[model samples]
Target chain A: MISSIGRFIIGVFSSTGGVVILFLRTLYWVFIGPFQKKPVKLESVFYQMGFTGLRSVLIVFFVAIFTGIVLAMQTAYQLEKMGAVLYVASLVAISLCRELSPVLTALVVAGRVGSAISAELGTMKVTEQIEALEIMAINPVRFLVVPRFLALFFMLPCLTILGNLSGILGGFLVGVGSLNINPYLYLQTSFKYLELKDIYTGLTKSFVFAILIALVACFEGLNTTKGAEGVGRATTRTVVISFILIILADCVLTSIFYFSNM
Target chain B: MQRDYSQEAIISVRGVSKEFDGRKIIDNVSFDIYCGETFVIMGCSGSGKSTLLRLMTGAIKPTEGSIIIKGKDISKLRTYQLDELRKSFGMLFQYSALLDSLTVEDNVALPLREHTKLDEEIIKIIVKMKLSLVGLRGFEKYYPSQISGGMRKRVGLARAIALDPDIVFYDEPTSGLDPVVGGVIDKLIKDLSEKLLITSIVVTHDMQSVFRIADRVAMVHKGKLIQVGTPQEIKNSENPYIKQFINGLPQGPIDFFKEDIGILEEFI
Candidate 1:
């Protein structure tokens, strides 16, 4: 029993070390990879961006708009009782800009894009395609992982911004059409309580979440074993691990940014 | 069965051993493969043939000793240096390993596009030429999934020889095919070896494939090489293990059952 517990601890540490090494290698390849004979293909990066960002726009838009509407409905009810219903706009905007849009966008991507990355790569691993790449002198990390990494890094913030705007519009619609609040007053109050720092904080969190999702997905995919069943397990693990790490990162960064603002 | 010393040795495995989880997969084994010859490594399923092939290709490092390709120890080379070395080698996997995302032409053109500065027209011509060489000329626009298994393997071969590599490695080149299709693949392997003068190393258990293409055959048994000789020499070998493997014998020195000490004592 003691030996089994020791083995479990060792397994966790070694796995953590493996992920760290993969992260470092990815960063090194990103900066120094262009000078290599087989540089990261720009076409591949563009393709990844299209898939991870452009294809995902409609889903993110709809989700964000709904979240805004729900936030306004809940907060407006309580604020109406206190004769401060105008504050619902501020509440929705603050939640969307400072927290909801980034976190929710990341969660959506972790479920959709992260799972796809893991499954695709895991299939490649089992099929000996990854080995074939190594045999051909191609760095799989540079060839496969870097493009996804850059795509997520460049697109997540843009998606978050789009989501934030859609969310505010949703809140505005709710205030004016449903609650009979003045449109001008709702618009004014939405920006009245929000600042550039809030937007910046959300975008920063998004960028970190992008890295977390990409790294975990690629790492799990590359380490996949046992064939088809293994790919399924890796895809599932990518989603679960990305959720845990993204939330943890969000908490830590929020704390730091909150303290700094104070 | 005497080796031709005049021909240059392209790859030399010197006392190589490989282990996994404290279990030895390849024991101390050494052999030299000459340039422009088809060397076949043959064994039963659990005999570590694939592991040995991977070690020679520098896809995996050995646990001990060295695999020297062109006088460079592959085990000692850094990751980038290994990548540089790998440019001279191409490998066709068992399932063909074609990128499902890329069309056949794109797959064949991958090496040239990545490693060379040739213009699009030049790459197109080269892609056509490579495809034609493997009889995949008009199937350029098809994805791997759209093609039959044999056609996919042919496409894989076209891609493997894309950069005009000095060497090509094939893993189970003829497995999962009917006899007629298998013969066609064997002919292609021979044709490529003769025409391109590229050194070929094939890992397979197919006896017919072994005799049809191999200039020299290495028979592996339980992670050790039992014999290395010409195909004719291998067929004539008196080694019981080789006899069993070659003839597909049900009973020989290769025991089918693993008996405990007590079980063996009872039998005695």
Candidate 2:
């Protein structure tokens, strides 16, 4: 069992190392002489972002709202028993701004956009379309990856804001209407307790997560081997890696924030 | 039987070798594809036929040696240069790999729209002409999933010819088609090649298509191109591997049992 665990770790390291090397090579081509001059397909970028990010608004909105409501319900129940129902707003605000919003939004995006990126690029790789692009003097990285990376970089922040708004609205409905809290009091307390740093930190995490998700998805898709089976593996790996990375990043960022305060 | 040497070859592959992992798949293979000829690459499964096509097409680089397309060493071309070279040849994949999300017209129009400065109106005309050439004139809005495999292949052909490429590479064009459809595809390939005067490299094990359309057939065996000749010469060639493969004989130089041994051993 220990040996198997060691082998798995070694395998992951090698795989990651391979991906890094390929990514660097792609970057070199992207920045270098010939490839840089190739015309950027702006239409492809907008189309992909619209398909990957915009079309996913409903899913993210639904997930965020439900998460906020559930958090409010659970926290209000415990806090009310302790005669601290007013602290429920703080709990919802702090949690959403600090941890839940960014991480959950990333998870939702990974499920929606990450898989789509991997599958789209993977299928392109499988069908030799990527190769066809390369043969056409179009840099696959520029033609495929750059647009996606840019789309996700810009769109994830937008999704994060949307997620944050919907989550706050959900908590408001549950806490103010159902829990019979004073609307003015809930609003005042949430505003008072929530620091700008908390919101900034969440947004920063969303940015990093977006970059991570895009990199992993494009990397896996670009390097897809075998055929259909390879595509499936790439999609699975993108999601799993994005999920783990988001959590790890959240923990690290949280530590940084806490330590800075200390 | 010598091909005319005055006309410069469009694609010249010299001493190419490719290895996957540690195993050599394509070993020092060399060939020159002229501008207006149907060059058929024939080999049994796993004979590195497809790999050769990929190397020639610049899809994958040879580990050793070079591929020169139209006086440019494609293996040495920058990404953009290679892309320009790639535009010269349109490839039809074995599965007729039409993008499922795209309609037939969109798939056919993709290359023209991507690489050309032609207006959208002109692109549409080109798309229609190409599709009509392949007898898919009215199936513009149908997605790949909505079409039959044969229809998908025709759509793929239309896409391949959309840009009026100097060369077209068809990877096992008749692999999955019925005899009737396969013959139709072969005729289409022949007709298109003739009408457009485009050089074509078709990789296939389909013997009937080989006889029907190939101006010359190059038989690849165990990484080396064992023979290159006309269809008649290939039939008469005494190379045991060529004879066994072309005749589909179970016994002889090409061992079916040895191939099965690896799989059976894995199970055991």
Candidate whose TM-score is highest:
1
TM-score of 2: 0.89
Tell me the lDDT of model 2 at B65: 90
Top lDDT prediction, candidate number: 1
TM-scores for candidates 1 onward, in order: 0.96, 0.89
Q: lDDT at A186 for candidate 1?
A: 95
| Tens-place lDDT digits, model 2, residues B71-155 | 9998898865676677777888898877676799888888887778899999999898998898889999998989899999999
DockQ, Cα level, model 2: 0.47
lDDT of 1 at A239: 99
Per-residue lDDT of candidate 1, residues A238-259 (tens digit) = 9998999889999999899888
Please state the error at residue A227 of candidate 2 in Å: 3.9
> Which docking band does candidate 1 fall into?
high
